[model samples]
Target: MTERELIKKAQAGHNSALNQLLLDNYSILKGYLIKLTLQKELAEDLTQETLLKAVTKIQDYEPRGKFSTWLIVIGKNLYFDYLRKNKNLRNYEEYDSVEKNRVGNQEASAEDHVISGLTFEKMRETLGTLSREKRSVFILKHYYGYSYKEIAEIEQCPIGTIRSRLHNSIEDIRRVMEEEGLDGF
Candidate 1:
């Protein structure tokens, strides 16, 4: 069935239709959540929450765009809500332990191994320093391969704002990498 039909059925109280809609768009939603949160468990939890919220608010959904877009908006809001509650405090010890394990498991023969580690660390630090809005645009555009137009729609901002954010983010990353002496990487 078409998305509109599925949405109609879902709004009409068809549980199966709603489930199908969620199932069909699950990966997209999960990917967006993961990119936003950078934590698998948190992303999964937010995905479920987003789906539930979408279902509850399904009746208010207008057929203006793809249903998946609406679902993603819900997920994005939930992700921000999680961030607000968590207040950017992460377990640095756990993060370092995981990084150490990952580094040890890497092959010695890997290309650019010497610079790769520094580059990645620098990039992570730089990304963390970016404002939430700029980081969101960068991740959605580069990591998730979202178009500027789609990002604007998802972010509820103008396309020009998305473009500007992405541009500024790339420049910031470049400057940070240069300062860290890993620009060649």
Candidate 2:
């Protein structure tokens, strides 16, 4: 069945249709959360929360946008709420131990391995430095390939605000890279 048909069924109290809808978009939603949160376990937690919200609030979903986009909007809001209620404090990351181990030196590696590892870490750090709102705009636009209008709608903000946030976030990342002498500079 088409997505519209599935959505219609889901809205009409077909539990399986709604389950299939959430299952279909689960990976993309989780991946987006991982990229946005920078903390894998937190991403996992938020994914569950997002899914629960989707299940409970399926009736509010409109068909004008992709279901995945709506899921992303919910995920973003939950993350922001978490940050606010927690007073912007994040505890020690259990995922970082794995990340550190992955970046460990390998005897057979060449320049590519070192460059890529450092680049990835630096990029992650730069993004982590952004405010949640700025990071949301950046992730929606660049990471997820969302159009300005779509991001505006998902973020429930003006299109101009979306554009400005994306621009500022990019500028911040660029400045960080330049300061760190990245990109062969």
Candidate 3:
């Protein structure tokens, strides 16, 4: 069945259809939450909360945007709420542990893994310097390949504001990279 059909059924109180809908969009939503939160465990928690919200609020979902995008919006709002309530603190130790535990490419040599890990760490550190709102714009646009219009809609801001935030985010990252002698910006 098409996504529209599934959504219709989900909205009509079909548990199977709702489960399928969540399953279909789970990876996209989780990946987005990971990028936004930079903490795998917290992202997982937020992903679960977002899915629960979807299950409870399926009837309110509109069909104008992709279901994945709707899930992202819900997840994003939950993350921001979490930040506000928790005073915007992130557990970097948890992120580092997660990164270290990630499996390296089997085809690549150990040196490649080390270099890639260093580069990723540098980039992540740079991203950490950005404000949550700016970081979200950057991650949504660059990491998730969201368009400015889509980001604006998800961010609930004007397109110009989204553009400005993205510009500033890029400049900040570029400046940090240059300062740290990192190339390939």
User: Over 4 Å off in model 1, which ranges?
Assistant: 86-129, 179-185
Model 3 worst lDDT window (10 residues): 95-104
Model 3 stretches astray by more than 4 angstroms: 89-118
Q: Which stretches of candidate 2 lie above 4 Å from their native place?
A: 89-118
Ranking by lDDT: 3, 2, 1
Give the C-alpha lDDT of model 2.
0.74
Per-residue alpha-carbon lDDT of model 2 for 69-93, expressed as tens digits?
A: 8999899889878987887734323
lDDT of 3 at 47: 100
| Model 2 residue 16 CA deviation in Å | 2.5
TM-score of each: 0.70, 0.78, 0.79
Best by TM-score: 3
Our tally of clashes for model 1 stands at 0
lDDT by candidate, in order shown: 0.70, 0.74, 0.76
Better model by lDDT, 1 or 3? 3
Per-residue lDDT for 123-172 in model 3, tens only?
Answer: 67777787777788777866677877788788777776776666656667
TM-score ranking of the models: 3, 2, 1
Cα shift from native, residue 3, model 2 (Å):
1.9
Candidate with maximal lDDT: 3
